[model samples]
Target: MSLYETVREELLRRVRNGTYACDTLLPSVATLSEEFGVSPITVKRALRDLRAAGVLVTIRGKGAYVKKQVRILRQLDMRMHSLHGTDISLISVTREKISDPSMVSLAPPDQMMLCVRKVISSDGAPFLYDASYLSSNVEDEIVDEFGRNFIVDALRKREIRIVKTEIVVEAFPATGKAAEIFDVPNGFPMLRRNYKMVTTDANITIYGVVQAPFDRLACSIDFPTLAMEI
Candidate 1:
């Protein structure tokens, strides 16, 4: 690889891993040239590459600074937009009996369960993929008109208010299934969130997870705080 490509890869790694904090100026071209043992021209070219990638911003007389984190959700909150969207891309649906030991007790014995796996897209590009489970197979619910949040929608219909929620968010390389669904190369980095919904009666009403390509979603402030977006 060329010297600038080598430097760019390392710098990209630093920015991604938070070694170079967001909104902070990167090392000067002179300093980077010395560290990478390359000419200043090469370092400038590498920084320019990052700028084109939306990872860096160059200001006159101020060098380059990591771009401030931006929210990609626009006006819609994730929970509402992901489910109540007019632009959903359905992938597949499966119906099965409740078998998970922990979740079996959430509903009556022998309750038929439904699983909906879908993708959320923008400008024709898929960005989020999710697999949601519901306590019953409301076949008609698949219609966009009836399709709201599979979990919360069902609960709300019964006036079951979620009293408490438990959410776990983390980053992991995309699984084979997710990589294909997201149209990303294998093992691409992704953000995942697993959550449990509890009703006012203190019952765990639903459990499911959502995954999104890390690049499409700008993590909220505090770098890792982006994990809370789910």
Candidate 2:
């Protein structure tokens, strides 16, 4: 790796591991340069990239420090149709069952269980990795027809409507297993989401974990609240 990238990785590692707690001022450029055996210019470049990515903030007189964590916003809205109202084709599902034996569970016969593993990419780069589970026993036919984009529309076609959803978020260190799938260095920090998708007849709990490079992930949420009376 290039010197700048090495420095960037080190900085991110320290932040994620709590070596440099959030909002804590990092060492001066001179100190980092000496520690990394790189010129101050290279260290500055690395810091610049981190700042641009919203991972770090630089004070005019006090050196740079890590930024506070950003909250991830989850929004659920109706999918729009085209003017012609043509529906998009379902994602092709594969007949092959989940190869990961660790995911299998022995639930009661009445409960439906499904596991989905998807590698999410952005602009051609593999940026996000997700593994989700649904309680509704998806038919083999449905699995064979829709792959990654299978849930929302397939439920509609099956006459099962989702009435509500509950979402929870947390932060955790990436385990070795997760690091392998995410293709990132071990011990990275990631955002974990647990979702309960409720329908008229059943409730399916889905676990969605998003793992990405620290510099590449940004979470934002916007909502309105009622005005308070004086």
Candidate 3:
């Protein structure tokens, strides 16, 4: 691994293990450089990367701090992976009118969709709430699989391939049902990911919205992989 990345991983490990307590300031760049036997520039780069990774929060004129509620973002590549971790709990599946603006393009405005609701949890505590709005035509194929795996797998079962995708991410305050599910107070910051996928079958499009409390979800990208492609 690169020197800065090695330092970043080590720092992340410390944060996870409580060596650096939540909301507590980390060692100064100079101190870390001296301890790790790396240059100050290298330490600075590591800190910057950690901040971007959502493991640390840096304040101007001060050093970085371990985020009070840190999220270990899952890494994803070109392939769509299981959104939340492996632990999943099926909530409910029902037919509902397509009303969310993010999903309007997936079906006709007047059409009803099969909504699959599920929660992603860790050790029985739920972190992510996923609502997949599928084209009503594939009810039997997807209903059984979405509870155990992502929608992509169900689509593959029907010989369907996703040819294109668009994702929009935004942060909003939790309210009502959202707050109750995440066990957070109303107005707590939350992350929302709106997904739209187009499959080889023109009539079929997959649209989903995944929501999680801000501290419970994050996303990360490996720069080396992208750099290699270029």
* Candidate number achieving the greatest TM-score relative to the actual structure: 3
Q: Write the per-residue lDDT of candidate 1 for residues 1-230, one digit (tens) a residue.
A: 98889999999999999999999988899999999999999999998778756577788798999976543543222455453333666677667665544343334346566666777776666767766665564446443422344556655666668776666667777668888786555556677766666677443355656788677764342343455535
Query: What ordering of candidates by lDDT runs from best to worst?
Result: 3, 1, 2
* Candidate 2 C-alpha lDDT tens digits along 1-230: 99999999899889889999998999999999999999999999998878755578788789998977643232334342211222333222223333433233322223434656565554444445555555546556655433435466666777777776665556666678766764544456666544456677555434333455454454444446866568
All candidates: TM-score: 0.52, 0.49, 0.61
User: What's model 1's overall lDDT?
Assistant: 0.67
| TM-score pick, better of 1 and 2 | 1
**lDDT scores of the candidates, listed in order:** 0.67, 0.60, 0.79
Candidate 3, 1-230: lDDT as tens digits: 99999999999999999999989999999999999999999999998877655578788789888876646476544444544344778889988976766545444346787889888886566778999877787758558897777777777878889899877778888889888897665677788888878899987877788888888778665775554643
Clashing pairs in 2: 91-146, 91-147, 93-145, 93-146, 112-135
Identify the runs in model 3 with alpha carbons over 4 angstroms from their true place. 1-68, 76-85, 101-109, 221-230
Candidate with better TM-score, 1 vs 3: 3
Clashes of each: 0, 5, 0
Q: Return the top candidate by lDDT.
A: 3
